[model samples]
Each structure stands twice: as structure tokens, then as C-alpha cells.
Target: MHTLSQLRSGKLKGIKRLDLSCGLTTFPEDIFSLADSLEILNLSGNALSSLPDDLPRLKSLKVIFCSDNQFDHLPEVLGRCSNLCMVGFKANQIQTVSAAALPLELRWLILTDNQISHLPAELGQCHALQKLMLAGNQLQSLPETLAACQNLELIRISANQLQALPDWLFSLPKLAWLAFAGNPFCPMPPASPHAPAIHWQDLEVAEQLGEGASGVIYKALWQQENPRAVALKRFKGALTSDGLPQCEMAACIAAGEHPYLIGAIGQVEHPDQHPALLMPLIDGFSNLAGPPSLESCTRDIYAQDQYFSLENTLKIASSIAAAAEHLHAAHILHGDLYAHNILIGPENETRLGDFGAASFYTPEQNLLQNIEVRAFACLLEELLSRTQGSAATLDKLANLQISSAQVTISARPLFSEIKKILSSL
Candidate 1:
């Protein structure tokens, strides 16, 4: 939230990052003054429509965020910035993307909630690309050139006009996280009859539980005959990087009941008709790890000193595997199977949460399940890296990790098989 006055006065010089969001309409020339030190520039929540041609003068810039702006097209000069690797232009009027706008060293690109209908084939030139966010756009199909992105790990194509996903996407060497709900090819499953409707007036909202990209969660008290404490999730009614909150709600309901999954107890519709979910309140739990950092890119960040007992590691992995098997049986893909989404409770209990990236798939699309297997493998590998136990038990877990991460999608063991093998160990 740095102001133009402070920037113009040169008081913010020698900074590695700069954030300006005071209704700016044009690029500030003073920004170039910190070109030697500025590595990140955030101009989100502004009125800017374009950047100056000399934006490349910021030679140290590695990331730039211009979300919630008025840009209609990506700036071509971005391609000339050799050091720039991450670009975020979400929620803009961007309808055109020139091939020259893509940096060759790009690792992450976000163009969500835009009017983009086509993408330049030159995207294939970005061999280092990993994370791509393109939800809430008008894209009907992806360029086949994207298949060359072998390092790509996560992608979001939800809320787009996509007719079908390319088969090659399912075989990417590193592809793991994926979401494609709200597209023509993937219709959400019908509302679950098992999730009974609970009037919002019957619950008393308490302190906030937490918030994520799509919604706000709170602790609530269900004021029924047998009153009980419950968790309430009220969607923000906006398109997230994953997809619509409504789509997530649909996936949560479709997921039904599972021992390791956070199930929806009832559906809630406020007097104004805002949709919400009543869930069983989870007590005394914490996230297994933090989300990926700028350096880790696609991996979760665990505590440096964190170490799990071999028995606890096996239990956590087994619980998650059983839950994943259940989800696949119900024809659902938990697009995000990362450690950060797994909440660890007392006695080594684990519960998988966050349906924001979940999507429905047919049983025939086993490749999708295989893609998730790679994610599960990564989770297992992370746990193994933190555990020390009997060589035999550790060897078994390592074997499962290796088999689950096989480059050949069909070679990966199913969650059911993993669950069984884990139980046997």
C-alpha cells in the first residue's frame, strides 16, 4: 500500500519489493529508480490499464502482480525482462495475449477471471513453467504446444469454455494438481440427498475459524433441540483460482462420508439465499504444513525441525490413502492432495479438507486418478523425509512412494492398493 508521494519522495528506495494500490491509472516513472533492488512489484487493486514500454528497465524484477486492474492485454515488454519469472494479471479485462508477452523463464503465470479466448503457442517456449492459473476465462481449448511444458505441475482450467482436456495433459511428467469443474466437459454431480438442509437462522455464528481463497469459515452453534457446535462455511460467491465456490460446495456434498474426510453435515441457505455448509466442528487440529513458498514453487513447506514418528507417519498416510480411495470410488478427484490441506489432530489423526480444487470425473478417466497418485506420492515422500524408523518399515513405505510416482500413469498403484499395502506394513 505504498503511496505515490512516498515513492516520489524517494523514501522507499533500495527496497526489494514495492506495492502501490492507491487508484493508480498509469505506471509511475519513479519505480525505475529502485530498479537495482526491486525484485517484486505489486500494483493490484489499482486503475492501471497498461505498463510502460521501458518496464524492462527494472532489471531486478522477478515477479509482478497487476490483478484487479483494467488491463485489456499483456504488455509485450514483459518478454524482454530476462529476470522476470512470475506474472499475475488476474481479474482484468485482458482479452489478448501477445506471444511476446511471455517471458522465456516464466515459472508461474496467472490470468484468471479474464476475457482471454486464445493463447499464443509460444507458451511452449516457457520450458520452466510449473503453475498456471486460467480459471474464469473464455478459453475453449488449450494450445497443443502446452504439452511441451514437461515441468508443469499444477493447472487450473475451471470456469472456462473448455470442451475437453488434452490427453497429453494427463501424462505430463510432473502434472499433479488439476481442476476443471464448471466447464462443458465436466458437469458437477447432482446435489447429495444425504446433506440435509439446515436453515441459517438455526445457527449462531461465532468467531472465525479461518479463510481461504474461496470462502470464510466460522465456528457456529446449531440451535436445535440437541444444540451442538458446528463449523459454518459461507462462500464468497466469486470465481476462485480453482473455480466457483458453488462448484466446491457441490464437490463437498458429492464426496459424502469418509473417515478421513471433512463431510458436510447440512446445507445452509441464508435469508438472502447465500449458500453455506454446516460441517462438524474440528477441534484441536492444525495444518500439517504451510503452502508452497516462492522458492519451493509447488511443494509444501514443513517445519525445519519437524519430525514425525514412523508409526504416526504411517497412520497419517494410511488415513489419507483410505480417504482418497473413497473419493475415487465416488468418482471425485481431490485436485489438491497436498500436505497443507491435511489437518493433523491429537493422537496422529488426519482429516483432509478444502474442496476448492475438487472435481468430478467419470470412472473411465482413470488417468485423472493416476495424476492424483503422483500428488499422493509426493506427500508420502515428504513424510518419509521426516520420519526415522525400522529399516524394513521405512523400506516398505519408500517402495510404495516409488511405485506411486512412476512416470507411467498406469504403473502407479491405485489408492485402494496403497491403502492395503500400508495396512499390511
Candidate 2:
């Protein structure tokens, strides 16, 4: 929260980072003075529409964030920043991204909540790219050349106008987390309502437990049948990068009952009829890991103090794989299966939640399963590194992981097979 006062008094001299969000209408000319020391410049929450061409003067600058601004086009000056690899223009009005505006060394790019409709072919030239977020855009299609970016892993293209996904998009060896919901070509979930409905008038929506791109989860009291606690998730009533909320609800309902899955008891019924889920309130559990950071673009960041015992590691992996296999048998693909999405209880009990990126596909689509297998392998590999299991036990998990992560999509073992190996261990 750098202030104009300190910046003017030379009090912030030689700082490596600068955050000036005072609702300014233009870029402060004084920023150029820190060109020698500034590595990150965050000018978010401003009214700026463009950047000065001399932005390259910050020769060491590595990151630039201009979110919540009025920029209609990605700044062309950014291409000249030899060291700038991370750029964020989220919640801006950006509609055009010039080819020259992208740097070849760019790794992470965020353009969420923009009005962009097309991308330049030069995007494929960014071979070093890893994470790309273009959710909430008007992208009709992706350039086929992007398949050349083999290092690319995580991608969010939900809530877009994509009519179809490219074949190459799914075959990328490193693609672990991907969401392409809300597209015209996505499959419609089958009609099946196993979970019953609970009227909204019976429960009070209280303090929010958490929120995601698709919906908000809240802790509520169910006063109708049981005067006990429950978790209520109300959809945002808008298309997300993963797809429609109704689709997620449908998957949850069709998912049936599984001990490892978060219990979805029913749906929410209201006069306004907002799609919501009634779930068991889980306690004494925490996320197993955090979302990937800028540096670990495609991998999760587990807590430094968090390490699992050999038995606990196997138990967690077995539970998640069983749940995944169950979903597969139901023809549902849990598109986002990263470890960060897992919840761990005090006794090492595991539960799988978050259907935001889940999708329904035919059993014949073996490639879809293969794509998810890569994610499972990545999760297992992470667990393998964090455990102190015996050499034999470690060897078995490693072999299963290797088979799951096979580069040849056709060569990867089914989750059922992977589960067998894990269960035996």
C-alpha cells in the first residue's frame, strides 16, 4: 500500500516492490525513478488505460499487475520488458492483446474477466508458458499452434464462447488441471436426482465458509427435520470457466454415495430457485495443500510442516483413487483432481469435494481418463516425495505413479488398476 506521500518524500527509495492503488487516473511518472530497483510493480485498482512506452526502463522488472483497471488493450510496451514473465490484467476491459505485447519468456498470464475474443498465433512461441488463465472471456477457439507449448500445464478457459476444444489440447503431456466448462461443445449431464431438495426458507445462510469461481459455500442450520448443522452451497447463477452451476449440481446428484466423497444430502429449493446444495458440515479437516504459487506454476505447495506417515500416505491415495474410480464408472470426469482439492481429517480420513471442474463423458473416451490420470499421477508423486515409507512400499507407489503418468496416453493404466496396486501396498 505505497502512498503518494511516501513516494514523493523519497522514503520508498531503492524498494524492490511497489503497490500504489490510490485510484489514480494515470501511471505515476515518478515510478520511472525506481527503474533500477523495482522488480514488481502493482498498479491495480486504478483508472489507468495504458502504459508509458518507456516501461522497459525497469530492466529488472519481473511482474506487473494492473487488475481492476480500465485498460481496453494489453499494453504493447510490455513486450519490450526482457525480464517480465508474469502479467495480470484481471477484471479489466481488455479486448485486444497484440502479438508484440507478449514476451517470449512469459510463463504465467492472467486475463480473467475480460472481453477478448481472439488470440494471436504468436502465443505458441511462448514455449516457456506454464499457467494461463483466460476464464470469463469471449474466446471462440484456441490456436492449434498452442499444442507446440508442451510445457504448458494448468489452463482455465471456462465461461468462454469456445464451440469446440482442439484434440491437441488434451494430449499435452503436462496438462494437469484444466477447466473448459460453459462452452458450446461440452456434454450435457444426464438427468438423475438421487440427492433430495431442501427448501431455502428452512435454513439461514450465515457467514460464508469459502468461495470459488462457481459458487459460495456457507455454514447453515437446518431447522426442518434436524436442528443440527449443515453446509450450504449456493450457485452464483452465472457461467464459470468450468461450466454451468446446474451441471455441477447434476454431477453431484448423479455421483451417488461414496464414503470418500463429501456427502451431498440434497439440493436447495426456494422461491427464487437459486441452485444450491445441502451437505453435511465437515469439521476438523483442512486442505491438504495450497494452490500453486507463481514460482511453482504447475505444482501444489504443501505446508512445510505437513508430512505424512507411510501408512497415512497410502490411506489417502487409496481413498481418493477409489472415489475417482467410482466417478469413472459413472462416466463422470473429475477434471480438477489436484491434491490442493483434497480435504484431510484429523485421523487421516480423506474426502473429495469441489465439482466445479467435473464433467460427464462417455466411457469410450479413453483420452479423457488418460488426461485425469496424469493429474492423479502428479498427486501421487507429490505424496511420494513427502513420505518416509519403506523402500518396498515406496517402490510400489512409484511404479503405479509411473504407469499412471506414462506419456503415451494409451499406455497409462486405468484408475482401477492404479487402485489395485495402491490397495495391495
Taken over the whole model, the C-alpha lDDT of each candidate is 0.91, 0.84
Each model's TM-score, in the order given? 0.97, 0.92
After superposition, candidate 1 runs with Cα above 4 Å error: none
Candidate 2 Cα errors over 4 Å, as ranges:
211-216, 234-244, 266-276
Backbone collisions counted per model: 0, 3
Ten-residue region with minimum lDDT total, candidate 1: 188-197
Residue 256 of candidate 1: its Cα lDDT?
84
Q: What is the lDDT of residue 319 in candidate 1?
A: 96
Please give, for residues 1-425, the per-residue lDDT of candidate 2 as tens digits.
Answer: 99988888888889999999998998888988888999999999999998998899999899999998999999999999999999999888999999999987899999988899999989999999988889779999888889989888778887788876678876688886777766677666656555555777889777899887678899999987558799999887655545667777777778888999985777678688677888888899888899777678778999897788999999999999999999888888787898888899999999998887777766566577777888899999999999996998899889888888877777898888888888788
Give lDDT: candidate 2, residue 242: 58
